[model samples]
Target: MSLVRISHYLALCGVASRRQASRLIDSGRVTINQQLATHTERVDSLQNLDICVDGVAVLAPQDKQYWLYHKPIGIDCRLLISDPSSLIHLLPQTPRLYPAGRLDKDSRGLLLLTNDGELTQALMHPDFYHTKTYVVQVDKPLTPAFLTQMAQGVTYQGAQTRPCCIRSLSGFDEGDTFEIVLTQGLNRQIRRMCQALGYKVIDLLRTKLMDVELGCLPENTMRPVSAAELLSLTQLSELTSLS
Candidate 1:
């Protein structure tokens, strides 16, 4: 019997990322063969262990799936009891998946949804340092000092942000439009950074995540992750280490 960590098994079943699965186990939500499971415990995959979380049986591992969506502004990535505009309502019911990272309801752009929990963990973990690109519009005109300070890094909420690449976009009629590439995703990071610099973000749109791009995708649409894009992501050091 090939024994595997329960967290790995849960991740394979798309229950959650490995770390999150560990949390679930810690909270006494996971069971194997009707016995409570632990994070360090392993089970034989070939044995077809009766794994349950909160009394719901976990289905066998399914083929990994990946998708990219152009999230529209005003739509949340979460499934909230009170919010009717959550993105989950628009997605198909089969092949359950979760968003790799969240985009603010006020922000519109690319979001990756997948059943690959390992991939999700790799992308969301700060140590992986995956890059996301965004085009932002602020409430006022751009200043050289503002651009330089933003690129250098901004201190906000008692923590300093990592240095990021920022470039002003010319020829756009929008006031103070610029593109920024970030490796770390904090809560409302771009908006918070701009606010700390005395600039209010008028619009924020993410165009890319890692090697995946939102190119030409219409708003409120989703597409399967292309083979080339998946290849690029898997080739990254962080993902390769997962093997």
Candidate 2:
């Protein structure tokens, strides 16, 4: 293997993102062959190098694993200090696994977890335009105008959101329920869009992302993604890369 930058190597090992890996090196938490490593250092041979992050050895996984997790509301997607409610702690005690995309603490539904950093980068990259679908409940009945605005793209904080697909789900005991599909994953995007239209989101649940669906998986549980699913994901990544 060719010599790779420490940050990129660390990212491939699932220790952190490239930027986070650089920060780790600068903070003196990373060591190469038992000596403190610098952000500019490169690993001549991944197999021969002894890389450690905060005393934990960093090694790339031989086989990347992908999982579909039904994250429950109130559980954080990222690891939290001393917090068992985090997705990291909830997952099996395996190294190098990280969430592909995040669902805020108040939101719940399907979340993808994987050890493949490259795949994560591809799926999360803005250029990929991966679609994510959500089932949302709002405090008021949705007007045709509201739906139109959402589908046509609404301006938020001086920037217009990308056009999205929106449909009303039949039968809601309270408030209005709608299915929204977005190609962009903005921070608290669904909630913010509703807020901008004078609607308060009471509950938000992500139902699908790309070709993966939440299905009937129990909350707080996870299972390996199927081979067919992985193929679809990889094909999508390849298409994005070419584009």
- Whole-model Cα lDDT of every candidate shown, in order: 0.86, 0.83
What are the per-residue Cα lDDT tens digits for candidate 1 across 1-243? 577899988887887788778988999999888999977788776676799988889888888888899999999987553679887787666677778889999999999988788788788888766899999999988888888899999998898999999999963344499999999989999999999999999999999998789999999888998999988876773554664
In candidate 1, which residue ranges exceed 4 Å CA deviation?
Answer: 79-83, 171-174, 237-243
Best by lDDT: 1
- Evaluate candidate 2 by giving its C-alpha RMSD to the native, one decimal: 2.7
Model 2 per-residue lDDT tens digits across residues 12-50? 777665656677888999998899998678776446568
Candidates' RMSD to native: 2.4, 2.7
Q: Least accurate stretch of 10 residues (summed lDDT) in model 2?
A: 166-175
Alpha-carbon shift of residue 136 in model 1 (angstroms):
0.6
Indicate the residue-level lDDT of 222 in model 1. 85
Q: Against the hidden reference, what TM-scores do the models get?
A: 0.90, 0.87
Pairs of residues clashing in candidate 1 = none
Instruction: Give the lDDT of residue 187 in candidate 1.
Output: 92
